[model samples]
Target: MTPGTRKSALLAGTILSLSMLAGVASAETTVTMWTFLDPNKTSPREVALKQMIADFEAANPDIKVKVEPQDFAQMPTKFFLGHQTGGNPDIVWIDAKNLSGLDTSGAGANLDELLINQWPQEDKDDYYAKASFDAAMFGGVHTALPLFNGGSMIYYRKDLLKEAGIDPASLTTWDAILEAAKKLTKDNDNDGRVDVWGFGMPLAPLKTESSPVYISLLEQPAALYTGECEIKLSSDLGVKGITYTADLITKHKVTPQDALVINVDDVTDQFIAGRYAISIGSMLRYSVIKGKAAFGADNFDIIKWPSWTGEKPGATPLSGWWVAAWKNSPHLPEAGKFLNYMLGKEGVGLWTTVGGQVPTRKSVLESPDFAGPQYDWVRLMVDAWGQTGYMDPPSCNTRTLQGALNEATARVVLDNLDPVEALKEAEAKFADAQ
Candidate 1:
């Protein structure tokens, strides 16, 4: 054969190989995920999540993740309904309150069968939030992997505490914090209106399902719900939690009256604007709050929830978001790979450093990355999750429960109803939901 003929044959072979490679790439599986966060956005958490997905794609050339951002409050209802109608995405983000119907409806697949979820006992034990994982399980099968496991705690100004000579340790109980708030509330310019209030927390469920402050207090936590899934908000602890939240507005005046209509995000903004010396905020707000703290991010740190009875630390609701697979997705395995990658060591590690989340991994939280004063709040939260935290029992009707509890707070704070009577009304409303 001629040398020119041999060259043409080699070129043909290379062209065929390129075509086959492109075909293989085109056949890659796409795993669709429904979450509240838009990875395309510029927020820190969103940017981190986007980076995580990019890294996962780089690692696994055969799988692709398509993130569908939804309103977080709408995820549960939309997902459950989608499951019923065969229109759900391959994966979904399940918040704590909506975990009840997951297993029963088979909307969430048994994640235990996933290879990544079958971690070694040591790897499993390394996860700090065990209850979070347990909360995702139903009927002896794991339904989801707990991705962002965190709870509410007090974010306070270190500078304010030091200036007022208020020892941080002494503010261990709710009552003590109230006293400190009163001392901190002052008008530096001698005006009738106070400039810097002592505390700020959002009690209105006007925007969302319920108030996180009220949840941490009333659910104060597992004790609030009885055997029949009936919430006993009228209990002593419940009444106490209720009265404490209301009195802060009406009696103590540490928190502004306008707080009655705002949500946690609104109050976080107020605290960042330097309106409050201390505020009740979710652990998820750590990075955002840290960035905007007028007193300096390092000067701002979270403390453990002040104990109600002072016997133990207050309840940290086993709250936060979860990543679960759809039972009917044709791409279930690929979905698990994406979910596991996002929740694994590298991904979960980024949650602390990049996303500002209190991840479920202990080693990630305890690492050198999380060391020092800025991350001390992370330690306090870890302690609470490991020791005193509790999640509410699974209930199909959490929206109603939250709505009822919100009315209870609104009536007490706005209408001046007795705390006991307010809570009794809350229980009655919760019962009506059943």
Candidate 2:
């Protein structure tokens, strides 16, 4: 071949290569996500998320996800604050308690409009339940997708209940629970002191444990929300719930009196030490209790909250981090696609199998991956989500609400204040906080 022809062909090849690279770069889109978890971290959730992101990227080479880790408690507040400066993230992770505030902020995107409008009802029905989507729904629109599921339940000694001839199902009512507690409470050495308190509940306002317990075990606190940020917990129904909780420590003597000062951590310690038959706790603590229990790890299992009547189980506060997109994000379409990918059946299924989270999809929960004895806790939690009611977080100050309730409980059980009086004080404090 002639030198001139060879040189012309080489020049044309170089130009074509440069043009292709430019096309690829121009088509690529980057989506930024804000979360408390660093994908580089080795935690199970982080690891699973990291792998999921990598998988998404591999499947869609035109898009890249940029994760920006933020402090969890501050993420929600910071997200709104950033909106003021026009520097909001493309996507954000929000805690459930603060989710109501998201609607008023006007920064959250309408996920139903962006993603779910075209989805068939069969696909929509695949979600765990109405609450699964309702938690993210605001003013008749979905603003986010539930990323994980968490709820508090009573962790009990399986062996102790069997020895006492108490079927866990029989303790479905508070009255039945009280009777079972009476039987379970005993002194092993014939001492006049109880070696095992039938139940342990953390009532200290200084700790957040008791407040979660109070919310998880009943729906009244959420029911009292006036929709205008006012909570009338001083009402007759509210007073009744508080009275029952206090009587367990003050009158029935089934729960340890020391619960007034101890938190859930302390209660958990006492439980593992075999000084309590049942305690208010979380699934996150299940593995720890199982590994550390003095009596036997296999003896520990969970029970859903009992109701005032045996008609229904008390609501569990079933919420975890939620995934949302900025309403005015420049990359709204791309962000919506990423959110769908992250929350899709395969994605959440991978999360349950690898991240060790409770699956949020009914199909995933029933899948073969969840089979076997090791996943009994997962099944129990699935029932907790399916069979019982759930606590709805208020749009107002959740911490303040919890504080007021905790203080009211402390006053009744510790200072001997009247339940109505304490409830009134709580109502005033909560009103002032809002």
Candidate 3:
């Protein structure tokens, strides 16, 4: 079965099982949660989260929080299936891109009334406007609360750029990046083969949905659809983005010719090993790789992705998970209390520091403690958030459309297919699928 189908089945089973357990919770109120992050990791977030849950349990002696870790890749399908089956968890993590799908599925509970009635105006104003707005409405109903806000940035090796004699400050456009890449690409072993690549990107089909290639190419002012039922990849901006990606491999030869097969982990590995000078990734990516990668923090620095038309460079798309309560959840009041606590000052601060994720709250962003060397990129990201776009297409059949897009990209870059013909065929397939 496809991954989506398998997730749907798992969620259906979970819902049925939970329904039977619901009746036995009279003595203790248990709030079930589904999340993508693995708590077993040695990251600060993992440690803090465990402590947070323990503290929550201590404070709310009558309630217990039971977490069910799920595969991130299957979260959307499982969430929809559980909602349809009346077995959704009290709280779950949801990707921003799936807002439209959740709204159409009628799976999420409207939280606007709760927010207005319960939260203070000061608390409401703390959140970033865009993050708050995206979570507030799904199919015209407020459904979820923003958790962590994130945006993409360019992570480059400073030493490598200096060695190439390229001024990092001047590398603000696609043309400049290509020129730097040429200078950076080198073979130190005196072999004919080039050992170092100019750039690294996550091109593996496994991570195609959240890959940087898509963000670099398709996410822009005119490329994304804000509605729940439109596809806008045929626009001039979209084409420009795609052509630029093709050019990186075919025209400029900066990125590896086989990049389409390299996953994010592999890309990170290469960057750490000094195989590439530059990479595109989310802000949290640096934190995640800090101790794990060979390169120390001093070796790399973050910047905005290069612009195309001489306009100021824009950051990549801003997106992250949100927390939502199921409409039928018995512990609605308790869940709301926990959510509020999570969004409060202490909770947001702990979560942000541990997870290396930007806070949704403006107050947290403005905190004196948060204004540190670690958050410089985050500030730049927020400043450029308006220029970024969410990564979802409006059509319900997005998976099929995405598959066609990936295939078209692979054909043009790897198979030597004509770009014009490949794009035309891909568009035709997308239109037919929709």
Candidate 4:
């Protein structure tokens, strides 16, 4: 079938499945769920989520579910507007990066009461403790429940690395990465043009603002709010991380000079098209590369981010979609019931499979079903996340602060400004945002 035809068929199938199971809503129970993921991606995790929802509907005939999907970039504004109009979803999927902002705004329901009263102790125990803890205590109140979790992993084209004579296994530090990048980078065609870039990473402030690069590197406990309204990105460690990223382009010349101009989609496209040997971002790139780019799993591989000596090995920032009820949601009890169903064993398994996302449930992570090529790296990623991960802190003005850091990093890398000076300027701007 043509690509368009296949896409249409997939959509039709999803709609049919949802319709078949959406039984009549009880007068008191209508659970509305809004998320930032597109439903048509056909990622394993997404497919499983659909199935889980259908199963939930089948079992709970009295509670109807309404799903509204939005793009990631548009979610923040929509969430705020929903808060203002008190028309938000009963369950909303939020990124960890936005937790601080949500906490400050008091837009979400505190899940503590629900957890204590509704969730089984075993079910609560099944979740990764840190994720569960983080979700439960935003500003000392349980604000959300972990849905899907993921962390960054280094993505490389093995064929390209072999041609460059670089041992992928030996890449354990930024210096080694730079050396490999140099070898992989070359004018493949003799037409006075470089055919492949050694590395490609998002650097545009506007684009990388939400990309999770800096958060991964700094390993700060929280970037925006310290729960008491203090900004922490102006620290020495933060400066070091920012400088290291800048050096990839300015000093090492490993990445594309115009990397700052590219967004996440552009970087992913270039990597899939074999325009770069290495790309750094979420491990879910495996699913995208496999399904969307039509590449086999064996064609690419992943590694943890290279380490910085004397300090703990840094991994990419950990973040994911979380389920939370809006403070004004009328269907609280049903929303709570749907949440329990979604996080249950079957739901967890289906969501992890279809979404191509890691399960937040420790039971699911350790289950025999999770053992496979597609999920092996998830284990490694989870281990690394536990060791080196940092969550965004609760801040009264998180988005603004994040924007400032993005601008500071961009100026240093793209505009060739001094790193220290740029960061100092960023710190000042961050302070002003308060």
| lDDT score for candidate 3 against the true structure | 0.69
Off by over 4 Å in 2: 1-30, 160-165, 179-197, 204-230, 235-237, 250-276, 283-299, 371-373, 393-399
For 1-434, candidate 3 gives per-residue lDDT tens digits of 99999999999999988986875664678888888765565676666567667878888878888878888778877988988787788888776667666677777766765454577777767776554455537555668877776555677888888877887888787778778888887778978777888877666655543333344445364445444544555455556656777777788777887778876567777877778888765565666666555667677777776777547664366556777777777788877777767767777887877766677778888989877887876676776675553444433555555456666678778787765566666667756765
What would the TM-scores of all predictions be? 0.89, 0.79, 0.83, 0.83
Report, for every candidate in turn, its global Cα lDDT versus the true structure: 0.79, 0.78, 0.69, 0.70
Tell me the tens digit of each residue's lDDT in model 2 across 132-208.
Answer: 67787888899887887776678889888999999987878777877888888888999798899987877766544
Better candidate by TM-score, 1 or 4: 1
Cα deviation at 168, candidate 4, in Å, is 2.7
State candidate 3's TM-score.
0.83
**Root-mean-square deviation of each candidate, in angstroms?**
3.7, 4.9, 10.8, 10.1
**Deviating ranges (above 4 Å) for candidate 1:** 1-21, 207-223
Cα TM-score of candidate 1: 0.89
Worst 10 residues of 2 by lDDT: 208-217
Q: Tell me the tens digit of each residue's lDDT in model 4 across 42-123.
A: 6665666677777888998777777788787777567867898887788887776676656766787878776544767876
Residue 191 in model 1: lDDT: 73
| Error of model 3, residue 256, in angstroms | 1.5
Q: Rank by lDDT, descending?
A: 1, 2, 4, 3
